[model samples]
Target chain A: MTTAAEFQIEYLQYLQADGKAKSDLPSFASDETLMVNLYKTMVQVRAYDTKAIALQRTGKMGTYASTLGQEALSAATGAAMQKDDVFAPYYRDYAAQIQRSVSMLEIYQYWGGDERGNCYQNNPHDFPMSVPIGSQCLHAAGAAFAFKYRKQNRVAVTTIGEGGTSEGDFYEALNVAGAWKLPVVFVVNNNQWAISVPRGSQTACETIAQKAIAAGFEGIQIDGNDIIACRKIIGDAIDKARRGDGPTLVEAITYRLCDHTTADDASRYREDNEVTNAQELEPIKRTRAYLTDVGFWNDEKEAALQVECKKNVDAVVEQYLNIEQQPLENLFDYHYAELPANLVEQRQEVIEGSL
Target chain B: MNELTLVDAVNQAIAHELASDPDVVVFGEDVGKNGGVFRATANLQDRFGENRVFDTPLAESMIAGLSIGMSTQGLKPVAEFQFLGFIYPAFNQIVNHAARMRNRTRGRLHCPIVFRAPFGGGIHAPEHHSESTEALFAHIPGLRVVIPSSPVRAYGLLLAAIRNPDPVIFLEPKRIYRLVKQDVPDNGEALPLDACFVLREGSDVTLVSWGAMMHETLQAANQLSEQGIQADVIDVATIKPLDIDTILNSVEKTGRCVIVHEAARSFGVGAEIAAQIGEKALFSLHAPVQRVTGFDITMPYFKLEKHYMPSVEKIIAAVNHTMEF
Candidate 1:
């Protein structure tokens, strides 16, 4: 036998599940202000997610995907990205969208069934929430191709669930990104369960990160619950991509603590004890624990943060509810640059209540 | 002015846009150095650099998804699928994303892309290479499906499709790609979309068809003219936002109609035209609308393709049937 090539997946972590450090922390941990901001953002995301689910339960919104145990992944990715860089996010990356200036009111309006919610007033370049699995990966790569073609130092970042790796579109995106040496970063949120299907059943591979190696690139695994590690590892990948060193795949290992969405009942297929055990290792708890142990956070500070997040979430809900329904013509207007003659007649009929 | 075939006109139009618009990009399997399988994009990568015209990995979904992304970023991406039969993999991206991008975002972003592919059956080729599934795209609300039958129309409509501020499904008829030649001017003039071309005017019957089927339809029109039954031949260049007004006017004048297509008869673009004529022009139509189309089955392989595809004889028979009725 002759040796050809060998590769190893590198694992990264800073904070353990029990308010302890696994090793020396990354350089960013020394910045107390940044760490506090990261914690605050994660808290806000959890609050927003909770309110969204409540609204869905109360018949105020449509089916909502809650990012209950994955706030650290969203917050860290958002923090690492620059304003000019585009973020192609999947449905559960609300924290990252908020960081990019997509308001909570807009998110509410989206789940409430309004197209105007996608027309971001501030963040014009970022893509809307991609509900289709693994499709956004190619869009990110295409955006990266445009950036590289224009000779701009910008990176395109995208997130997908671990189960999405099975999609052909996902592999196609990775292969093209590798072949073209495009500046894109793929972050796989290995949240253990894709709806009712667990990770073990989703793929036979030992790790999702190693899938990138097949595309001729480096793939790394990270402890997604650790806020410090999430930010550091994803930030490093983004920086490398921006420098035109080609694409990287980061597989963040986390767990989905809630049902897949407001429509799902996880208890039907999941054990209560397993859920209880996973909750102990959830993202927000460990980050909060780490902050408390380091003296950066206390009971008083935590209580204040919770209140602030609630007030913010409530205000956005009010705004979302107060917005008026878009005119029926809006449905026909944006389908083309200018409505074609056929659509014009259709729109008129709609307005006249004859359609 | 230069004599050009339909495929030649396609190449000319793409090359003209690549030269004029810096944001225009061309990519697909075998499109770069090979100039496409049909040579529809011949010499483009050489004329423009690799960045402007390039080849992509053989993934239809990626080609479509990439075009959506590039188009959102202000790049006019003209992507090609090797064949219309091979475009099923990208159907989700096209229908869900490319078609809905502008509407979903409320005009915050839109995909100004041209998805081109060689379509329809005639020349002997393998299975999955000859498909005239234009109706599948024409049925999509946000897409503009345009097919060209002649060199002049091909050159002009392609320019229009590339410049349209929305996504267009540009299906080239491989059957008639080199069957005819015409003097096509190199001027970057774009014909108007959402309109039909009146190839010949008559007062006996209106004949409607597009793509390669237009060849047989035109031949049928000529044969009908020789028989002293003046027929109005209408080329429905853009089938999606159909120019029903022109068809209605022609049918009202002629008082009879016969629609032709190479796709399956059931629920085809031909069916849509017949339904519209029934709804709005029923009073004007002297006889029932007749359709000459392929049977509702898989497009047979080369040995049986001629029997499956609509023929000039079949179109003439349809016209005679409409006239006799």
Candidate 2:
């Protein structure tokens, strides 16, 4: 018998769930200021998610997906990316979006059912939050193609739920990325549950990261709850991609602590004990513990950070609440670069009918 | 000026754009060394190099999604699906992303892409290769669905679709890809997108069609002329943002109309044209508008393909019925 091929998936972790170092820290962890900033951003995203859920509960916003337990993954992914590189993010990637210069107010407006929210003041090349499962992967591949074709030193980053790995678009994206050796990173937030479907039922594969192996690329698993591991692994993948080393899939294994969205009730499908167990291993508490133990954070500073995040979230919510409804013409204005003659007449008809 | 077939004209337009615009890229399943299955992109990869003209993995959804991503990044990507029927896999990407990008982003980003697919029946090909499903895309708001009949229109409208600052579904009528040739000037002139072309002028009745059906519709008009029935032949170049004004004007002048298409009869482009004519030109219309279209069934394999398509005799019969009425 002859063995034609062999593959192995590597698992990475820097900090254990108890806030103790499991291995030597990556170089980025030595940067106290950068670590603090990432920690602060994750805290800020949690604060924003809390307010967003409250808005939905109060009927002020649409159904909001809570990024409760996955903040480390989102924040680390965002921090690893450069400003010029494009990001195609899924719905629960508010932390990444904010780090890319998309404002909290804009995200609020987006969930509030307004199109103007997608018109980011900065980060114009980043794709708007794609709601469809697994579709953004291919978009990232396309962006990578453009970067390679133009000889630009940029990489495209995209994130999807572990469940999205089952989609054909996901595999198609990986295949194309590998075939073209595109500059892109695929980060799968293995948050255990996709809505009500658990990771075990989503696929028979042992790890979501291994799916990239079939596409002729490397795939690795990381402790998604450990911000140090998340940032280091994702950052290395992005750097490798920028240097034209092809694509990599990083499976950040974590747990979804909250219901899929405000509209869903996790209790209906998941056991209370499961949620209880997952809460103990959530990303924020361990990161806070590590930060505090390392002397980069203290009770006074934590209180101040919480206060600051609350103040920022409150200000953005106020601005979002006060924003006037977009004009009716806005509906017709952006449908094309120049409105055609028929559309011109149709717009007039709609305007007159409104009158 | 060079005599070019419709497919040749398509190649010329894409080649011209690739040469003119640094951002214009061409790619599909076999678009690279193979020059596409129909050779519509023949010699494109050779002329433009691999970076500009390349082939992608056989995934339609990826093709559409990639085009959207590239277009947002200041590149005008001309992505092709091998066949219209095969484009169903990419429907989600096309309808949800490409068609909605500009509107959803409020103009911050827009997809400037041309999703080209050879569409319509009459080619003696197997199933899935011959189906005119332009209505599916025409129903999308931000997508411009354009089809060209003759070589000249193929060259001009394809150029327009590629240059238009929005997503366009450029459906080439494969049935007549090499059926006829005409002198097409490679002058980079683009025909108007939201307009129709008046092919032949007459007064008795209006004959409305586009794509492969335009071949049979024109033949029917000529046969009608032999029967002392003058017909106004109008090619609806752009199906979406349809140039109903031209059809209306012709219908008003003739007071009778017949629309022809090879796509399924129900909820098709023909139905939209007929409805529009009824809406704006009801008083001018002397008789009920007639439609000669394929049955609402799967576009059958080659053996039964002709029976399923709208033949010249069926179009003539409908026009004669309208004329008699």
Best-matching candidate per DockQ? 1
lDDT of 1 by residue, A126-171 (tens): 9999988999999999999999999999999999999899999899
- lDDT measured at residue A342 in model 2 versus the true structure, 0 to 100: 75
Clashing residue pairs found in predicted model 1: none
What's the lDDT of the predicted structure labeled candidate 2?
A: 0.92
What TM-score goes with each of the models?
Answer: 0.99, 0.99
* The candidate that achieves the highest lDDT relative to the unseen native structure: 1
Q: What DockQ would you assign to candidate 1?
A: 0.88
Please count the clashing residue pairs in each candidate, in the order shown.
0, 0
- Model 2 TM-score is 0.99
DockQ of 2: 0.86
Candidate fnat values, all: 0.84, 0.85
Error of 1 at B322 (Å): 1.4
Give lDDT tens digits, candidate 2, residues B171-244.
Answer: 99998999999999999999999899999999999999898888888888888899999999999989988989
The worst-scoring run of ten residues by lDDT in candidate 1 chain B lies at B316-325
